[model samples]
Target chain A: MNETGRPQELPMSNPRADRVRDVAKLAGRPARLKRGRFLAEGPQAVREALVLHRERTAAGESGVVHEVFASESCLDRLPELAELADGVALRLANDDVLAAMADTVNPQGIVAVCSFVDVSLESVLDAGPRLIAVMCQVRDPGNAGTVLRAADAAGADAVVLTASSVDIYNPKAVRSTAGSLFHLPVVLGADIGELVAGCKERGIGILAADGYGTLNLDKLQDENAARRLGASAASSAYALEAPTAWLFGNEAQGLSDSELALADHRVAVPVYGSAESLNLGTAATVCLYASARSQQAS
Target chain B: MNETGRPQELPMSNPRADRVRDVAKLAGRPARLKRGRFLAEGPQAVREALVLHRERTAAGESGVVHEVFASESCLDRLPELAELADGVALRLANDDVLAAMADTVNPQGIVAVCSFVDVSLESVLDAGPRLIAVMCQVRDPGNAGTVLRAADAAGADAVVLTASSVDIYNPKAVRSTAGSLFHLPVVLGADIGELVAGCKERGIGILAADGYGTLNLDKLQDENAARRLGASAASSAYALEAPTAWLFGNEAQGLSDSELALADHRVAVPVYGSAESLNLGTAATVCLYASARSQQAS
Candidate 1:
């Protein structure tokens, strides 16, 4: 180890090396689950992982980034990554080696292997989250990632992917997150029934975003506006400003009747146009942002 | 042609037929432009196109769908399609042939050849649009398609793609629209400057959605709330409830200063969380829905 506690670096010029193959294997769910590691591709995701690792290590927590592989030009482009890599292993890799280690067609010259950093559902709930996004059976990786990005952007305390949901560590999902994966706690493989019960017990209102809900999201926004205007006292009616966890369902089927029954209220984002419905990701964003805006105002 | 004005069809058994190659070539921009036709892949898009064509023809306008190629199973699955093919040519093809003519991994057993239905910028402006989404230099086909879907959902009158933006007919984009492409008019190759000027002449307020805008979208929503409360007069302030065209810039660079200056107001969708920013599609959705809700309430 060097003085900074980072492992000695070696130039990786061979794309067919065993190490490259091992890193590339993280693209598959089976390999990721078996190894408990995943590839964070591109400069943006790699930098975020390194930065988060540094922050966690500084706070006496386990680091997230296992190792970083970057071409010389990539290191030059993102010099701060070197500083962020303190106490970590860094490998100088050739373009082909970096490409082979990444899942993207053009990885922008960097890739990192990171341990699964998802927090336990218990841990996430224990922290008393104000805003949470619970995705149920969201099969599309792009939709899953986009929802995560939206959740992060809305300043949601955490995002929970139900037991049947797509793998958050899927390369497409991770890529869709645009580095937001490293920004907040993501809980995976939680039982929906227990999650609902847990949130109810924790004083968090579990709201289901459904197209057929009797509760209109616009009305919810208006209620918040009424509260903001001091026109009415905050009643027992579901208020978006209150601590809440939004339950979103499968892209195709949406929330089944049983799943919808689990929520405190099923709220529909009002569709004024002739177009049938909003996609899962767009619906999630509008719902999260509605809560976010109301909370900020309150 | 049959008595119903629909072409009598035979089962297209050959995957390598000249007609199949001609349809497959529409996946490329050059062929689509040259032939003035594009492929609308999958059941949803194809169904919507045929329905729209029927509606238009019933209203004494030109039909949109020139022809539809579907597998026997697809036709069996969607029996209503037979009714929709009233005046259009229908060809029964093998699954392999349908797949070859589509851009998707799975084309859902049908593809439709439709003439370019984009209206001129002048026609869009002539309609005196209440809600429009103007995408400037948007390069990602997926983002462009998502915006189209969002606009359609919000009941926007039309969507204008600037001359430099991605081809609205791009196969990936067509797939992303999820059939919203046929729900409304989509204008292509419009000059941004003329659009702004045209919107101005029609008393349509052009609001630029930007990250660095002085106006916050939440505040804009608040203004509508205030208006709804009858606390203030609608004055000269740009109102979401008013006839408006939202101008969205490229995903990466956003609106150049010059472009921002062209709009009456530059508005930012407030970012309340640690996420750097919402993706272009999500941002556009929130903005469009905000306007949609306000307009509907008014």
Candidate 2:
């Protein structure tokens, strides 16, 4: 073991080695499912995975990161990863080997093999999440990842991906999350109905973000402010400051009538200009931040 | 002209045709500049370009769209494009021809040759804009496009891209705008110092959206709320409702100290969680929407 108590390793030089191929395979959904692991590419994602793994292992929890393959330059740039080497397997690899093992064209010199980090819906709800982002049938991987990142930035307790949504483990989605995938609990493949029920049982108001909804987001914000100032009674069901779980729908078709009915209120972010609508990622960020701001103010 | 006042056309069946090659060349910056035109791909963009072209021609302004090449199915789906045929050249092309002329893998069966619609900095400033978004040295085409889309949705009168920023005419950037590129005035390649001076002279306060800014966005929103309620004087330079132009910097490096110094106030969107920061698109959306909401309320 090295001074950091991590197993000593020889540098991996072969780009076509079996280990490199195996790591690369995790980029696909079937390979990830079969191996029970996914590749977190780039320095930010790998560092986050390693840090979380160390914290979880210290807390006597199952470690998420199994192995980290980094180029010499990446290791030199991030000396903090050295301390994390004690709990996780760290391997130095040639730039070509690291590139071969990564999904992105430019993997930023580091990649980590992490076990599936998605938590169960029941667990996420049981923790009494104050703010949650529920993506229903969101197909685009980039949008899904951006929503996850937005939710994390807004301080949401968790993100719930409906069964029909894109796989959270998709490499593009993982890379898009930037490191927030490791920062927060993301519950995937949860049934929307069950998730809504759980949120309702936990006193979480479910708000649907739709472009054609009756409830106006600006008006809701005003109402939230009024309620906070004690100028109005807390009678409105669409209060933005309430413990909320925002339900965002598909990219192209948006939420179906049945899906919109599931929410306490279907809220529309006011379109002040001639642009048709905000894209899924931008809309979700506005909605999530609205709730975050209101909750913080209250 | 056809019976619907649309130009009668024989379908161009060959993907290797010179016309198809010429349209495809607009995807590059040099070719676009040489031709004084850019390609707007997909049905949505083409349709918007045609609509804008019709409006501009009616107003005796320079036509924005020179020609639209669409597959039979696309023309059938969007019958409204037929009316635009009288003002702009409308050609029917085979699927392969349309695909060859597009930058995206699937061009959604339509593409338009659009004249450079970006106005001069002086023209944008002369309009006496209310809300505007200024991207400084933003290298990513997608980020630039998204910022434009967000600015348009927020009812911003214009968007200004600094000289060092990515080419707004990039195919990926145009695709990211989702037709908003045709909705508002976008001024490209402006000198940042000159743009700042112009905004200041026009009574437009410049706000820099930075992660480390001392002025908190939430507090600014609160002050705007107080101003709306007549509880606080509207003397604060950081007021959200003011006629303002938000300056966003590059994706990785953010704003330099010199760039931040040009802004009247450096505003940070409060990060409620541990996620390091919001992405460029999301951050711009929040900042723009905050201004939109405040302006509407006041």
**After superposition, candidate 2 runs with Cα above 4 Å error:** A4-8, A231-237, B232-237
What TM-score fits each model? 0.96, 0.97
TM-score of chain B of each: 0.95, 0.96
Candidates in order have lDDT scores of 0.88, 0.88
Highest DockQ against the true fold, candidate:
2
Clashing pairs in 1: none
Over 4 Å off in model 1, which ranges? A1-10, A232-237, B1-10, B232-237
* Weakest ten-residue segment in model 2 chain B by summed lDDT: B228-237
User: Candidate 2, clashing residue pairs?
Assistant: none
Under CAPRI classification, how is model 2 graded? medium
Q: lDDT of model 2 at residue A25?
A: 89
DockQ of each: 0.76, 0.79
Worst-scoring 10-residue span by lDDT in model 1 chain B: B1-10
Q: What tens digits encode model 2's per-residue C-alpha lDDT throughout B60-108?
A: 9999988888887877887777766566778888889988999998998
- Score candidate 1 by lDDT: 0.88
